[model samples]
Target: MGAWSRLKGAFTRDAQISSPEDLLAQSRERRSGKVPVTNDSALRNSAVWACLRLRADLMSDFPIDVYRKVSGIQVEVPKPPVLISPGGSEVGMKEWMYSTEFDLDRGGNCFGIITERSGVIGPDGRGLPGRIDLVELGSVSVRGKGSTITKYVIGGKEYEPWDVWHEKQYTVAGFPMGLSPVAYAAWTIEETISAQQFARDWFAGGAVPLAELKNNAKTIDREAARVARENFRAAVDSSGLFVHGVDWEYKPIQAVASQSAFLEARQYGATEIARFFGVPGDLIDVAMSGSSITYASIGQRNLQFLIMNLGPAVGRREEAFSRKLVSGPRFVKLNTDAMLRMDPEARARTIGARITNRTLTPDEARALDNLPPLTDEQYGQFDRLFGPRSAPTPPTTAVPGASS
Candidate 1:
């Protein structure tokens, strides 16, 4: 069976699996055809209804966490909020409700306790007795393929291009129940109060123009783009763009600079026209830093491996963490393996049959010509290294500058 089919079968046969239909039926039985309409009773009924609906929805959306969350409902109740507010307000709550109680016809079987509370004004301008809250009905988890590594053996030695394969699993906990009736009622009342308060605040001169907010957001985006462009330029410049010991070679640094400038210009233009903007040098910096670290780490790891395989004489370390030369044979072997895994047909075409003491036929040469091109850009660099042309030639003219 396919992987997904096997997973589905396992899930279907799980003893703890609870279907949404079962939960809905239990909810119906709990009400016993008598839907509560009173404010307090209605709220309780709504909470129960929410639990049923949530359970059903989560059964389809998060099948993996179903068993654990449903079975462990009793255990998840006392746990602190998976979500909460900073001001000690019970803004978010979580609870797990089980199906066993429903099956046994127990009063509290299908229910989960909600702890957090938010007060809301009633229609009579009085505080509502109950408040809106969140609860967790169950938990779900999923696992999938992670990382991959490729290795190749040539001339009685083995080389690895990528050396790690890791898998990741995710778990989420929340209520399968719908919103609590009391919470909904409280929220409606609170919204009415909030609308009035908002009107007061707005008339009290706290409200600002939507255009102004848009302008501010745009300003922030432009500033962020400017900063990003500056950082990118600095990085590229420091890395140096020139091709050493080569003629008429185009520098990749110029392309990087051009791309960075284009991105900056586009960002500035977007800031001028767009209504929404992002914060400058905030969370984006964290992401950029992470990306930099990932790229650097991978490059460093590969370089280290290559140097080690090349041996001490040619691959001398300039610093404790630096390598002077790398093993060409090992690099080629590893690259071939990676290519084979990524594109088997292409690898087969590139590494055609090698018959001993045989001359290539014209048809064979033609077949070779029809083979797919190499995906790696490094091969082009290698070709240039050994080719007649060795130095990069300056561009005759700069690319047309963008109109401000």
Candidate 2:
């Protein structure tokens, strides 16, 4: 335990608690010739936002199911009230899950204060969580001795570890807190943001090249030059005509390479961000070259994403939910079948094939499409269109010989 605690402290050496307002202010500040890295500033990049949103959106859409091992098979069980409405009557599980996942993706940690618990006792002396109100990470301070979190200070108020619900990902050995990917990707995100700002400022005339308007016949004085330059800039800025004398010549300096390089840098930043967030570049509309990968269908692409990118995150969440939300043999499963849903035509063919092969019942297939079972009239209609579904043939041995 002591060794584990020491390792955990090493990972969280710079841990500090601050208000959201303070974090936002710090994010706006420039420090040591680099943009201050914070969740808010990192999200300023469109690619970063897209990656986080994609993960959170998909993860939240997946339905949560509780199951217990029965006879060596997973049998679905009734979800605890906390799993159903984790945040209380005002917030459903989907919204809660989305918020939690968003935090995990951004900060690698999520903190919530348990407000209520069920009557059923869990492994911990406290009952299972009935309501957990998520707190902003900035407002929560985690204090631990070695690997054991002694307490949580949220909004300057203290609470026991049992009273605080914490989930972390991207973990290392003995670390109670997850490592923030944003922290590691800070330079990339900052570079992207700096490029964006440069582009904005450049278009706004901050970096416009100096131009000289000189008289071919006679040299102009400083005062005359300043007036002419101001007039020219004002006219250009407002899209007004700048009528110059024929004697005067205007030659503007142009550096086209910088603009082209800026564009390339921006593209590279997007691709890098996609990589950092474990999202496919194409999924976020990030252009990349020198790749020949292709997907036969959207389902195949989604399947690859589910397996490669989201699988581990989903597993971590499942483990956390199983350990904390349920007890004994019961476990939690986030149904990712929704992510792999095929197009209507493809889905129909697959379901039809399953029914034909006796792998799935007609009613069960209908349920997959969220339709109710067929009535007698519908069965009659089906029988008229196609022969009735054949019942399995009964096997006979000695009885068949006797009948013969």
Residue runs of model 1 more than 4 Å from their true location after superposition = 2-8, 11-133, 136-246, 251-404
Q: For model 1, what is the C-alpha lDDT against the true structure? A: 0.28
- The lDDT leader among the candidates is 2
Clashes of each: 25, 2
> Candidate 1: TM-score?
0.14
Each model's lDDT comes to 0.28, 0.82
What does candidate 1's lDDT look like per residue over 77-149, in tens digits? Answer: 2211221221135332222112321211111112122222324332334332232222222221111122111
- Among all windows of ten consecutive residues in candidate 1, which has the lowest summed lDDT? 324-333
Give one digit per residue, the lDDT tens place, for model 2 in 295-377: 78899999999999999999999999999999888999999998998998999899889987889998999887789999999
